[model samples]
Target: MKKLIIFCFAITLFSCNSSAQKTEQKTFEVSKTDAEWKAQLSEMAYYVLREAGTERPFTSPLNKNYKKGVYVCEACDTPLFKSEHKFDSGSGWPSFDREIKGNVAFGSDNKLGYSRDEEHCATCGGHLGHVFNDGPRDTTGKRHCINGVALKFIPKE
Candidate 1:
């Protein structure tokens, strides 16, 4: 009886520590060294794009931007979200209902003690932000709460 309990406990322990859920390392089209990234991006941009850090809400000037243009990845210039897809989610972050297909990637994020759908730039694997379900129902019901520091707006000509 004691041996059975010990065996079960060992199995549970090992199962919890299993690497089955470990995310695979992905290769991007654009890769650079840490130093190169730091040199190319601003301090805040580097934090949000490279380190997955979040900026203070309402701090990004892009949050209220309404001009017609495309928002691109600050690190790789990959077109991410279009201005038309952006909306005032009131989440303080620049919220988008959709992304330019294949330009953005999704991954699991459990940083906040809960699982979230994390978004990233497919071109350079730069962390953008997380996507939630609470969005405008008329369109794609996804609120891509992105860190504005991770994006660079290019006005339409």
Candidate 2:
């Protein structure tokens, strides 16, 4: 009788653990084709916006950009990062102190076999860029190192 009780409890615990693991593995899917993406964005925009390509540093208009507006995804026009969160990290790329709530997702980027946090658009699952821990103290202690070409700044009127 004692052995049977222990076996039942172990099975229940294992089932619960398996379900929890499955729930935690949820991820967004980005299965759009290049043609589909290009129909929504310009040539340059499509290259950097949906293809996860980086633009030349110091060449982005947003680098020295200081406007009171929202920055959105250039491809899908989804609101991702806010202008208030934008800051100069001196890395040449546009840096953000934070992203719009639930607008971006994170994943382990072992592309070069080096571990780094890669950021993606939560809505379309498009690769926006990587994030770092070094950032201003006024906002969240995170540096959302985004590609400038991936965004479109909507200046506040």
Candidate 3:
């Protein structure tokens, strides 16, 4: 009957709007409001870190960086990865063989119509990027494909 059809439609709408399938992020030690974060981060950094946006490939200067240093979260300055793990995955973005364990957290991202492991700064819960198993077989074999704008490089002394 008409009532049955309406109920079904309402259920579908609610299901689609629900985020039950997505992994939940924990409370970060460093949290900020939208306006506060926007004020500190550059336009692109804010987009990628705060808004969960990705930057254009091969456009980040950090992508070509080969210096010795550590990569920190642009949002909260939490160290995420080291230059030692940096590798050329040819994925356009800055790829890493592994993350500095305990500094980054993983979650499920089904945004692109498929499931991908999403990475974020553990301290601030800012969106970093995704992780894959297609990295160097010699290393940890994890391709932490990160948005360059999400990181700020600190050179080794």
Candidate 4:
């Protein structure tokens, strides 16, 4: 009975550990050292992109931008979303219905204790934000909630 109890305890311990599973290391096209990233990005941008942090809601000026432009990764200038796909998600962050295909990457984020689909730049692996199912029914139902600091808007010329 004691041996069975020990085995069960060990199983439960490992099951609850988040680090028990090994994550694959991804290589990005625009790789930079920590010092280089810090020197290149603003404080908030570095926080959101490199540290996987979130900017305060409604604080991003890009949240209300309605101009026609392409949103590119601030770190590597890789186009990630088009202005046409942008919409007012009312979630205080820049929301997009779709991505610029093959320029963005998706991964599972479980930092909030629950799993969420996270989006990042494929070129630099910068943390943009989480994607949700709540979006316009007429378009793609995926709401790509992104941090404005992680992006640089390039107005159509």
Separate clash counts for every candidate:
0, 0, 0, 0
Residue 105 alpha-carbon offset, candidate 3, angstroms: 0.6
Clashes of 3: 0
Compared with the true structure, all predictions reach lDDT values of 0.95, 0.81, 0.92, 0.95
Candidate 3, residue 58: the lDDT equals 94
lDDT of candidate 2 over 1-157, digit per residue (tens): 9999999999998888775466353444555677888887777677766666677788888888998999887766779988888899999989999899888888877767799998888877677889998988867889999888888899899
Candidate 3 minimal-lDDT segment of 10 residues: 17-26
Candidate 4's TM-score reads 0.88
Model 4: lDDT equals: 0.95
Tell me the tens digit of each residue's lDDT in model 4 across 49-148.
9999999999999999999989999999999999999999999999999999999999999998999999999999999999999988899998999999
Judge candidate 2 against the unseen true structure and give its global Cα lDDT, from 0 to 1: 0.81
Which number leads on TM-score? 1
Q: After superposition, how far is residue 58 of candidate 3 from its true place, in Å?
A: 0.4
Candidate 1 per-residue lDDT over residues 1-56, each given as its tens digit = 99999999999998987788686778889999999999999999999888988999
Sorted on TM-score, best first, the list reads 1, 4, 3, 2
Cα TM-score of candidate 2: 0.75
**Pick by lDDT: 1 or 3, better one:** 1
lDDT order, best first, reads: 1, 4, 3, 2
For model 1, the stretches where C-alpha displacement exceeds 4 angstroms are: 1-17, 21-23
